[model samples]
Target: MKVSIDTDRCRGFGVCVSLCPEVFTLTDYGYSEVSVDEVPADLEGAVSEAIAACPEHAIETL
Candidate 1:
């Protein structure tokens, strides 16, 4: 699976970073960003959780 963050919809809550650090990180500007083009097998579940936990619904899978 692939993941991407819609920066326009982000509010820097850090839920994605806390739930899926392996694939997500907070930018210097405080928005969240995806660290990989494709989700690793081990991190897929965590990424999914992050997507759901995101209060702004900023994370999406492709």
Candidate 2:
């Protein structure tokens, strides 16, 4: 699965980063961004958690 973060909807929350450091990261400005183009099988669960935990609902599978 591929994931993308909607920056406009992001609130600089660190939930995604905390849940899936391998795929999601906090930008220099503090918003969350996707670091990987595709989600690895081993990390898909973590990414799903991040998506569900994101308060802004900014993360989505593409």
Candidate 1 regions off by >4 Å? none
Best by TM-score: 2
Question: Global lDDT for candidate 1?
Answer: 0.90
Between which residue pairs do clashes occur in model 2?
none
> Residue 62, candidate 2: how far off, in angstroms?
0.7
Question: Per-residue lDDT of 1-62 in model 2, one digit per residue for the tens?
Answer: 99998888999979999988999888889988888877999999999999899998999898
**Residue 37's C-alpha lDDT in candidate 1?**
86
Local distance difference test, each candidate: 0.90, 0.90
**Whole-model lDDT, candidate 2?**
0.90
Candidate 1: residue 14 lDDT (0-100): 97
TM-score to true structure, per model: 0.95, 0.96
